[model samples]
Target: MNNIPFYLAAFLVVLGVLIVVHELGHYLAARFCGVKVLRFSVGFGRMLWKKRLGQDRTEWAISIFPLGGYVKMLDEREGKVAEEEVHRAFNRQSVGKRSIIVAAGPLANFALAILIYWGVFMHGSEELLPMLGAPPNGTPAAMAAVGNGELVRSLDGQPVATWDDLRWMILQKAVDHESVVLEVVNERDEISIRRLYLSAAGEQGWEGDALERLGIRFYRPEMPPVIGKVVANGVAERAGLQNGDRVLALAGKEISSWYDLVTIIRDSASRPLRIEFERQGEVLSVDVVPDAVLERGQTVGKIGVAVAPGPKPAREVKAFVRYGIIEAAGRALEETWDKSVFSLVMMGKMLTGEVSWKNLSGPVTIADYAGQSARLGLDYYLKFMALVSISLGVLNLLPIPVLDGGHLLYHMIEVVRRRPLSERAMEIGQQVGMSILFALMAFAFFNDLTRLFNG
Candidate 1:
């Protein structure tokens, strides 16, 4: 869609993979519990491909829509089961076994998240460091005691090691007009502290200003001029710039920091600028002309090169070594639990009017994010997938009638009463669940549509 041909392809691949893994959990759990899974389908509606597998004659198929999938087990509730196979029917299974099968799907999703996150952490993902860049005129940070060449060590006493950390802290804290003490360390080993109070009346307001006052402003970290990305059909790409290239000078002016290069480029829009950079330790010179791009109604020079963090020595990617099987399992469980808790808290905030519902996203938004992550690199993609997996797991566990959590609720009630729910009651619950689920889907779908059309 938005100039990304491979975006849809990647989304489908990831969605398919996650669905297959989730369904496999149900299928395996059913098989182990002495139940027959009649069909294991990835997606819904008409089948695109189908095949029988194992002695169970399980119909493994790919369906038309890639939104979700299911394992249709042989159940007497849905239809009549053969006299011989009635013992293996889903409804006839013990409550514990039924619970296990229902729970397995979400557990599988959680497992996939942990594995993906572990891989990403071990392999290394790109992070933007807070490198000091030029501040806009009249901004809070620029006006209140903060200066150039000063490294931001922390915010509200929390360590600001990366640009992401800085951005999060500032955006979350800026609305409060709170005083922030900046720990600055210079090249001469001199450490100085500066306190800055954000202006509450300014247009650059912080997030949730009414609740708290925590004044902070984000500053670009002062990093060496290293090329991180070269956008396709952009100035840097046309200039033959590649990743890992270090900028030495622009327009014959010595460039020490990323900010210097950015300032020079922005000031030289539509004009030929001479650049000196190093690639593979070999210095080279090139002429680059910046193009103008309109953003927020202002025309700015666009260079199409992403500034990278400091370089690290090349090393082979290695897998994390587990101390023991028990330790690994424990860690996995803890990770999953933490992610689940975080998701629940966030959702609660959203529901309580503390967070905006505008932040809600659907498959289209997720696909866009997935595509962007894929474009970034493998590590980014892995992290994105892990986050998505966690989100999916949390969503499925929500106590809605059509979901695993809903089934668990029914099972719990049955266990307490020593009997299954009535067919009519179950049918009513299903209908209510369908309504709630469809309403949520509609909301998310419209959110996506709004973004697309508005853009």
Candidate 2:
């Protein structure tokens, strides 16, 4: 709750930047095509700030609504044009020029995404390796006999470099295939193939973690149930627990390992527990109520204790991934293209009922993600922004009325027919487009509220 203000600020920054980039595309393209831009607004509805600038005296404005913005050009269809400035009107431009102006907005968003990805890739960051732990019984991973501490090398012959790569490949494949073959190398250096069934992936409507549904998890090193550190003013500190204390049991059940203690604590949120431990050479007990906190939108118990340091793992669990300037630029282009295609595929699936519409996220969900990514670090925040930029670009390019793509569509038709659509027809198309957009917004908002309450 205390972070609400920070979250709002982050969301605003993301929205403001993307909107400005989008509108700037149209503004620049219009100016290049000799059309006069009357206003360049960062938002809609009642104007809050305005300033006239440039030789044409274009009104630069900010408005109340934050969701979107516009670059209004001087069009005779919209209003009267002076005889001297008639040649500079948007309607006087060629079809090719109009199409370029309409398409530039979405293009700008895509360019921004590519630029962000390029910078992040070049700067680099630590990423998790695609290492698998023991699969739970009866899951697809178990059926494939996936071993603990197995590093994924490839999925269905496609190379897998990091955990992110693995997840993305699996999602792409699972959308169409009932099974995927994974090539993995175990700790013993033995490489093998594992055919994993993914029929459930489709049935689940892609709602939770895909890896969890398949019983695939990251490797966790086993350690003893000893306290390495106790957080100040936390539940452990309040209960008189200290460093170097070996946990003997919790609520009369023997604590065999650190994981066992964690499982108990997580499932016992806000519940009182009797903790028995060994302090020095003597045994003692303490009563504590685990603190309930929201983690990833789920309520979990925490004792504010740190895991004791143990021996290093035999295999690397993380990798620092970076690329050279040229490689990073190439990879950035690929990433942008791949994500844009994936977004379109998901939307198509929704229309076909192959995927759930609940997957659609609203402003609230986006704000939540912005806050979380910002908290993670600059690399993650930039990646999140890049992803949102791609989404914005793809959405605007959709052939729906009132969107950039819709304007391009009109221009395309004009090219074919050698005439523009009637004013009444254009207005009707705008109305229909607005109605569709509104319905989608309503559904997305409902989904957001559902997640908030359910979580």
Candidate 3:
């Protein structure tokens, strides 16, 4: 409940940026191709804000719907055109030019992704070292004899500096392939090869906790039970708790680690807790009533206190990934291309029944991802935006009517036959395309609902 406003703000920012850039691509391309744009909208349905701009007097608008936007150009197919403006109509353009205009939107998304990746790479972040915990029993990691204190050196021959790198590699392989060979350095300082077989990975594998699917968990350092920062007006603050207070016990139970304290607090939502702590060598006990808050549809207790800072490692364990300008740009392009190709491949697999349709996601899933990434930090949020942009590019290129790719398909046919499809044929294509799109939307929404309820 406390983070809802932050989450919504993050979600809206990501959606607005992506949607505006996507529509701007079409708008620019249409103008360049000599098509007179009638309206450039940042959303759909009822207009909330509108203005006429440019020599063409294009009706620029911001609408109520935030899901998508469009650049509407003068089209003879859709409506009657003025005698003098008929030449500037979208339908009057050459097949090549029309294709360019239609394809520009997705291309813009890909370009945005490349730029985002480049920026993120330039401003690299500190990442946790790639250390593996013991694999769960009967899981692929366990079957392969993965150890608890081993450090991951690389995955499939690609050097991994951090857990993020290793996680991404594993997910990419799992989506398209069935196995991954890992190179790791054990605590004894011996290097060995371990193969993790993901043959059981299905479409549903992509949703939820991916690391859990692989039977892996991040190793967290144990922290002492001590109060760090207390939120203003929170239960901890109201109870007169101060920073640096060492919590010795909660509800008459000894609390050794921060994790133990968290579990106890969460379970005691809206309940009074008798907390014993050491402050300046003085032991004090206080009865505090935790505030109840809704967390993903369940009530949880929150004292609004953070963990005290821990000592830094003797040797720097955090890894940073950065590159020179030229290298970063090249890597950015490569990453964008790879992400786009992988997205397309996943869609194909899903269609072929090799991947589960349950992997499909709707706005709820996207919103959750946006919120999670934003909470992670700027670099993570940028990466998430880049990944989503690539997906938009790839999905828009699919040969379905009413989409950019569908229009391109029509253009190609027109080039070969030297004539556009009949009006009736186009109408039928639109109907078929609409049906397929609606079905996909329904499936994605259903999966989202299932996730919400199950979670």
Candidates in order have lDDT scores of: 0.74, 0.91, 0.85
Best by lDDT: 2
Tens-place lDDT digits, model 2, residues 1-455: 77779888889999999999999999999999999999999989999999999998999999999899999998898889999999999999889899899999999999999999999999999999999887768889998998878999999888888898888888878887889999999889999999999876767677767777887878777688999999999999999999999999998999978878998999899999999999998999999999998875567899999879998989889999999999999999999999999999999999988889988999988998999899999999999999999999999999999998888888888888889999998999999999999999999999999888876
Candidate 3, residues 281-368: lDDT per residue as tens digits? Answer: 9999999888887775456898889999986533345777787788889989988987887788778887787777888999887888
Which portions of model 1 show Cα errors greater than 4 Å? 130-337
Poorest lDDT segment (10 consecutive residues) of candidate 3: 199-208
Candidates 1 and 3, the one with greater TM-score:
3
List ranges where model 3 is wrong by over 4 Å. Answer: 203-207, 221-316
Candidate closest to the true structure, highest TM-score: 2
Report the lDDT tens digits of candidate 1 across residue range 160-254: 66554555455445434465666766545467776656444223221233212322333444588999888999998898999999999888899
For model 1 the local lDDT of residue 219 reads 41
Question: How accurate locally is residue 393 in candidate 1, as Cα lDDT from 0 to 100?
Answer: 85
Error of 3 at 293 (Å): 5.5
Quote the lDDT for 161 in model 1: 65
